[model samples]
Target chain A: MSSHADVERRLGELLRTHEEQVISRWTQSADAPRDELTELYRAILRAIEEGGRDLADLRGLLAELSRSRARAGYSPAETSKAVFGLKGALYEIVVAHADDEVLRGFIRFARLIDDLGLFTFEAYAEAREKIIMDQAEQLLELSTPVVKLWEGIVAVPLIGTLDSARTQVVMEKLLETLVETGAEHAVIDITGVPAVDTQVAQHLLKTVFAARLMGAECVISGIRPQIAHTIVTLGIEFGDIVTKSSLADALAHAFRRSGVQVSGGPATRVTVRAEQA
Target chain B: MERVPILKLGDLLIVSIQVDLDDQTVLALKEDLAEVVVARGARGVIIDISAVEIVDSFTGRMLATIAEMCRMLDAHAVVVGMRPAVAITLVELGLSLGGVRTALNLEKGVALLDHVRGAVP
Candidate 1:
């Protein structure tokens, strides 16, 4: 069993590994400028020492470190190297402590700087993921979709807002589930959604796109009036997307399309008549 | 999601998740779920999402991923206390998560897994 101390040591080692990856990539990449290497290096070291500290202290520490490095008579190039180095270290630190909100805060800060290299990509991806798993579980009691059949076609009903984080999840799940279940049609009913935003709408579109990639039909149902308005106002065309007024409607569409025969009249009367006949 | 420290539960693991279901929390969910599943060979995972108002795309994606991870590790993941609004929003957002399983509340979710021995064979 690995102890907390072991985890910490692994984090340090990860920092070194990330630094090497960053430096090696930069050295080989075409049009890679050499002016900021020193600054990056210093930033990496400072970040390591203060990686998971309090936010206020973290800011102050970074500022102080920058000033001290400047006072040490290093050239602009050297300062840049230090900063990039710090970014590389921060990248590793972010991955190691990616679950920490404090580390996420630093990633946000790094986003402000344009020259963050691959670290930015890694940080944002990790930060984005951390935000979803941690925040969603805290705020909502998210239920994982269970496979259920509606009219012989598999129906995976999702009940929640489609935020960026959850959108990615739905896309992945829909694909994997479809492959696993071998269901031809999937229905996403939204009668439970309270509101919609442009970003959330985009996430929905992405899910539809992903479902198609898996060679399955994705039907979105239960779009409320407000959601409709939001979509229209946001200039989001649901043309490529199939939508129904409600879950029932979506189910009906899916069923009809799948060539399932609708039962005539009521079940009780039909059973009695059949027995008598 | 608000993440509490890992709570040991005999052979099970209970991690209380705050209701913030966003991108960052999703990453945490993946990390925590992976670690818990891999290290302890957790028999059951109880995810408390009662605080969440909405399950965004990234969040939805991460949840699916966690469920998949649990199944791979011969464990079951039970999502507890999803708000009605959150559920509705996810549907409207057109997120289709298949293969993930859920229980209405923590008690049921946990109970459902207590008698089970992992993923369906």
Candidate 2:
């Protein structure tokens, strides 16, 4: 263990002595940007000077480098390569001196670089996971949008799979829009929804029930033939909640319920007559 | 004991619950509301809960019970101004408050009661 300490001390001395050469060589071989590589090199020197095995500063710098690279669209292998490049840079300098003790120290230094490279890989993976989580949240926000269809009427056009979290967002948004607009009617259009299982049906019923509890009636629209079939087969009863086959039909129903009369003008009637002829 | 005020507006008794309801307050409100409905011979009762922010299952049950009691006394009850969070929590707790009529605000609640009275007559 003492010899191991001795070798580590020798490596630190050699690193301090050949600082400029080591940094320049590392910059050329590493995949990282030049300015960041220089900053990291300085941190490494500071860690070595502190004279303990704790490379906390160096690890911090490396983690930051890997995270930024991950965000910049670099692959994990490329990110770790930035750390491993130091091994090749130090190997060249150690070979030039060609002493037995220095060579052992070089091996220990190479092992340290390997550990850092693995750490860089771990950091890169963590960054990618965080990016995925953020995108999922954004998708949830984007998928459920409550828009006013008419006076005293609002619509929530639901897209994608109806998970518990996404459904909660949709329900809250729909109910809030109902209160904000004083809309007595809400139409939940599910044309973009891919499938409707029992769970999705349950969520839909809950949303409608919640809206009803707020004194607003909900009209579920965009029920495709397949979904209608599935609903019947699954024995899921929507029980007194109005559902329409299309969004237009749902809006028409909402307008009718809100006592709004929608009649087309003579110009549109002439156009329809021309098309029929 | 804090009491929820019951205001008389023509044939409608408007009970606006403005405070965070505890068990005793809810029980008092129920009893007082029932008494007022009978004494005033009210045609409808509108319960406004827009100021109420939090509700557990007990409060949810009380609202339903109050509405049912008003119905038995031959007075229609409309719960109005229920916030989105409270509604969601009630639904999560599996209390749909099925027989209770709901309106967006007090004005709408009055309009709804007027409509119900018109339709029934």
Candidate 3:
């Protein structure tokens, strides 16, 4: 154990003495950029000078490098390989010296490099997971959008799998928009929703009930034939809540309930004809 | 116990709950509202909870009870100005406040009352 410590100290000294050669060799073998490798090499030397036991500084530098590489679309193998490159560079120095003490130290140093390579792999994976989470949150925001279709009417066009969390968001957004716009009518269009199970049906029912409790009427529209059949088979009752076949039907229902009349005049017909031409 | 004030507007009674409702306060408001609704022979009752932040099951039940009592007295009850969080909490708590009318705000509540009265008579 004492000899192991001695070898570790000798490896640190060897690294300092042959700093330029080690860094150049390391840079050539590493997949990372030249500047980053130089910075990481310096950080490792600083950490070694501090007592070699605390590799926190070196780990921080490696973690930062791996994170950036992860964001830049580098693969996990490539990122960890960049850290492992240090072992090969140090092994060359040990062989040149041809000393048993330095060779033992090189083995210890190789283990340290292996630990760092694993750390880099973990950091890269974490960064990739964070990116996936952020995109998922953005997708949630993008998919559930509540827009005003008319005065006293708002529409929430749901376009994905209806889960509890998504439904909760949709319900809240729709209710808030209702209060803001003073809309007595709301249209929840499920045209973009691909499937509807019992759980999805329950979520829809809860949302409608919540809207109704807030003193607004909700009309669910865009029910495809398959979804309609599924709703019947699932034995899910919408229960007095109006369901329409399309968004247009829902909007027309909303307009009728809100006392709005829509009739196309001759001027509109002429424009339609011109557009067709 | 703090009392929630009830203001009468023509044939309608407006009760806006401005404080955190404990059991006693909710009960007192229910009694006071019942008395006012009867004395005024009010055609509609609007209970506004715009400022209410938190509600337990008891308070939720009281709202429904008051609405039911008003209905028994031959008056329409409309709950108004419920915040999004309160509404969500009530929904999560499984209290749909069914059979009780709701409105977005005081103005809408009044409009709804007028509409209901017009439809009935």
Top candidate (TM-score): 3
Decoy 1 TM-score against native: 0.34
Expressed as tens digits, the lDDT of each residue in A53-86 for candidate 1 is 3334334443444444445654444444544544
Q: Put down candidate 3 lDDT per residue, A1-277, tens digits, no spaces.
A: 4565576677778998998898899888886678888888877776655657788778888889888887798898988988898988888888899777877777767777788899998888787788899998998899898998888899999997989889988988998898788888999999999999998988888888878888889999999999999999989888899999989889878888989887874245433345555
Q: Identify the runs in model 3 with alpha carbons over 4 angstroms from their true place.
A: A1-8, A71-73, A96-104, A264-277
**For residues B1-121, could you state the per-residue lDDT of candidate 2 as single tens digits?**
8999999998889999999999999999999999999999998999999999999999999999999999999999999999999999999899999999999998999999989999997
Which pairs, if any, clash in model 2? none
Q: Which stretches of candidate 1 lie over 4 Å from their true place?
A: A1-141, A265-277, B1-121
RMSD of each: 25.0, 4.1, 3.3
Which candidate ranks first by DockQ, i.e. highest? 2
Worst 10 residues of 3 chain A by lDDT: A265-274
- Recovered native contacts in candidate 2, as a fraction? 0.83
- TM-score of the candidate numbered 2? 0.89
lDDT (tens digit, per residue) of candidate 2 on A89-172: 888889898887789877766776788899999888787788899999999888888898788988898888888999999999
Q: Please, what are the lDDT tens digits per residue for candidate 3 over residues B80-116?
A: 9888888888888899999899999999999888888
lDDT of the structure predicted as candidate 1: 0.60
